[model samples]
Target chain A: MKLDRRAFLGTATAATATLAAPAVMGSARPHVVVIGGGSGGATAARYIASGAEGAIDVTLIEPSRMYYTCYFSNLYMGGFWDFDNLGHDYGNVALLGVNIIHDWAIGVDRDAKTVTLASGPSLSYDKLVVAPGIDFVDDAVPGWDVSKQSLMPHAYKSGTQAQLLKHQIENMREGGTYCMVAPPNPYRCPPGPYERISMVAHVLSERNPTAKILIVDPKENFSKQGLFEEGWARHYPGMVERIGPDFGGDRVEVRPDDMEVIIDGQTQNVDVCNVIPAQKAGKIAELAGLTNDAGWAPVMPADMRSRMDEDVFVLGDASHQGAMPKSGFSANSQATVVANVIRGELTGSRIFPARYSNTCWSLIATNDGVKVGAAYEPGEDQIESVSSFISQTGEDAELRRQTYEESIGWYNGIVDDIFG
Target chain B: MPKLTFSSILLAGALLAPAGVFAQATPIGDAEAGAQVYQRECASCHQIGEGALHRIGPHLNRIFDRRAGSYEEFRYSEALSRQGRDGLRWDLARLHAYIENPRALVSGTRMAYRGLRDEKRRADLIAYIRAYSDQPQNIPEASPTALRAEVELSEETLAIEGDAEFGAFLSAECTTCHQRSGDHAGIPGIVGWPQEDFVVAMHAYKQELRPHAVMQSVAQRLDEEEIAALAAYFENLGN
Candidate 1:
């Protein structure tokens, strides 16, 4: 590794002197630039820095100083966890030798291997990890746009939008209806919309018993559908109703000004409307030309290297690998794989087989939690599921409680793993 | 840099044991093979290393001769606790039977594993578990006929001509929740699998041999050819 570093430095210095490059300073250590500090980017930055043992320099570019995880934001809405608990700072990640920069990455000059930040000097990297998460397709939902977001909050990104949605639910009129316009298929968190509904129902069942929750879903079947349905029937039976694609869930429009949701030919006035629009890879990925026709960067199943550019690796919600959900756990798992690959490439470290796993736990009621999980391996075209398990519908109260507790434990463990 | 301690090196050697063929009691089964079985089947919920804390299940250090549900730190299920009261220790026979089918042995054991139906694999797993015990027990050799039966069953499951391209198209439904790219929170990523292993596993799920309902349904949907294609597709995905 040391020998490679010296050789790389000698070549880099010669190139820099000849090219007069503005981005790189001919440093002896290899630089790794990570864009987006959410689950994927933060974990990748931290791991690359630590795994290389000071052999590589890592810089993380994120617009937000504090990252609020989308994983447990539903729990926050249900009052299970405080809002502050969802926010994580990069103090620990910085301690791991990552240079944390609070700025949005505007563009990627792939030819020059440089990343242009919104407000800073451009940084050059020997390797780059783009994990900018998701960005909504602005016009996917008719009559719904960012300006009208205040009236119909998505709360999917887990920040102020989440807080706004929580406020709307809490301040909703008694006996009023709260409707959610769920996103299309292939979005982040497969079971997120139903989980949000369950959490909202949990709050309404207690505080506003007369209040109703309506779900306008584009997909007919969802993740943990049986479990969610059973839990809803058991806990908040009459309070929630989901309208699938058969019931005009696909042809829905929200009138933010009138606070009305139009499904097919019928329209109903609602006190609160959460419109989660269709989504794609984060904007930075598109700007970098890493995204494919599907708006997600294609990656090799083994190491997550971008199909378009080998020097760049895409992780988490931005990459199209296979068989893994776009969840924080999945991103963190991918980060470990990418970190290992980056370390091996730069520092001559050993790269292990990419064995990935994820478990999504959704809390239906206070202590009623259901989980779906599996162990996976790399396949020919994408990641594939090797084995899987899920909580049974008729599980006892003790088991449900334990499952919820396990989710809490996992949340803490993953946040620590990623941020630290 | 700190110098490597003699004990630390020995510990490392033990952990790095590729075949886990420890020089303890007369080796009945391959400890290394058993270790792999343990990793794939039990490591998720159970721990066996030094200072391993009880997770979903109790740590299994020195588990031989220990009464069922005897770990003080872990809260055992009622069935396991009752068996512990009855003075049932995890001896070779008990471990083999229990691991082969926990619910069958205890009736209400909370361990989520469906059980290892392969007789040889069960023997190997028991042998691995024995290696972790203070008083290692000798595993009785399996009869040639029994081993042959298990091998035949495994071979039958792997007899399929897989097409990778067709498998990729069929994988769309699987990737809906399984995730083709990115982090897998609770879902496992299945890429780069050996074709034979993939086929056998899918057959297990399709035949209602695995405990997971979703996988069972998924496997039931895929015909033998489709399953073979999926196996071929995933098998070629290598690191």
Candidate 2:
């Protein structure tokens, strides 16, 4: 769990091995080429290689050398975590005998069972795990595109954009208005927007108490709505206001040059505008013809295997599985299941029935955390929730503190579970 | 019909020689059933096996006859620490009662679990805990007073209708660890399992016949129909 010098050495060795040979040398070993070394893909690659005990070859294809988790980036905004804490290298994952390729997976040739990378030889695979995470729908918010990202950062992808958003929030003039255009339902991290708002409020509450936060949300209700509202009331009274769909929250447009957000056709100049646009599966999944009209991949509940292709498994935010939210925890949990299933299929290891679980923890303020968790089993059509538990609205401060501590522990545990 | 081994008797004698706490009878409960209970309820907080680390709760290796709050590495609640200071050893009766309701025995205890209400299930869980003792063969017999019939469901009992769709939705909590597909590592997979088996297992956890705290808590929340629904859903999943 500790990232010490020895761990760094281990990663260096693995990276050296990967660069030396783009494709694994053993032709007899089943190759698992994973796209997107985020939570799902990295966990899958690690688990498959470790579970197989070198019986199979795993080549993880991710363009980035470092992964910034979207999970706790909100905490980073709130100054609870540093930028370095959100970033992780694949050294630990590579240590598990996985070929960590830092290149884009441009295309997947299903007929040939090969993955064409942006700058490397096409890698062949017996099984492929696509966990490309979410890509914003172009023009999801009218007049918004990648070019205007610097002007109005989405900060949804959790790396440079997040830093940019943080920088903008920090530099906002005193008493300035911070406006957020929330994404619609079925976006990554159902509660993420709200949590981010809370974090921003936390920062603003300390720095510029006179500042205002306005949320123009598309949905009538959001995840943990009551808890968040209660926390906002208690912590930052009169400072935060939300406009739901009834008040034209969905009908909003932005002019990046003017730094103005128009809600219900009323243009308001704001110091900072966070526009989280509509989202879909990453482009690679679509390019591979794995996605449906919904812009997400349909996966079987049994093992997260793609409905379109049996050998290809889709996971995380990109997968259109029933009930489970498109959160990091859900993706990691799914990755473990997929890894085990794929390992069982390839290595002839002991395969058991699939079970899944996820818990989402949000910090309403410092030392104030709430969580919702559930256990699930595969159903006839989709993965289902058997039972669930969530933090109550009127929980005491001591319990909230404990919940926050638990979240910290969980963050450490999950990162270890995935990267290690 | 049961043969008492010499080592078991010797263990029983050694255990009884000092405390004379346990009733001189054979521990009669299903270890397998106890394992299920332990996994669902106790595994998260307590560890009983080799190299078990002290988690939220203390490691419980050879806990039988050990003084309360005596695990060297664990920081006990004041109530439990005081009980240990008073030389209160954990006998079968006390351990059973404590697990059924930790706060009842030692008020203000930090253990979050509510008491296990089912007496028969408590005995089975104790038997399972007893099996992990260093000299498990030496543990005394379970008290007859706590004994009850093993829960069994007939075809008619399992005939409770369930909707797979609803069951799938309800199973999200279970799948948090069980996984819908793949190697469970330590956790077992529940997919493609028979409906009857799933129902029985869930019922066992629900009824406190199993020792796992989490599973017991999950099962206790479900009705027979809900359990049946989950069973139906998992039964038809995977190959």
Error of 1 at B115 (Å): 22
Evaluated against the true chain A, what TM-score does chain A of model 1 have? 0.94
Any runs in candidate 1 off by more than 4 Å, and if so which? A1-26, B1-239
What DockQ class does candidate 1 belong to?
incorrect
Runs in model 2 lying further than 4 Å from the true structure: A1-19, B1-96, B99-239
- For A218-330, candidate 2 gives per-residue lDDT tens digits of 89999999999999999999999999999999999999999999899998999999999999999999999999998999999999999999999999999999888898888
Tell me the deviation in Å of residue A335 in model 2. Answer: 0.9
Per-residue lDDT of candidate 2, residues B120-212 (tens digit): 677667777765555533535432223332344567768887778557555544554465553344334568876866776676556554443
Q: CA RMSD for every model?
A: 15.8, 15.0
Residue A413 in model 1: shift from native, Å?
0.6
Candidates' TM-scores? 0.66, 0.68
**What TM-score does prediction 2 earn?**
0.68
Per-residue lDDT of model 1, residues A1-420, tens digit only: 555545545555544443233233446678899999988899789878876778888888888989999999999999999999999999999888888777778989998787876754566788999999999997878889989999999899999999999999999999999999988878999989999999999999989999999999888889999999898998998888889999899999888999998899798999999999999999999999999887888999998999999999999998899899988878887888888889889898766567566778899998888888776779999999887778887876756775676578667667766764
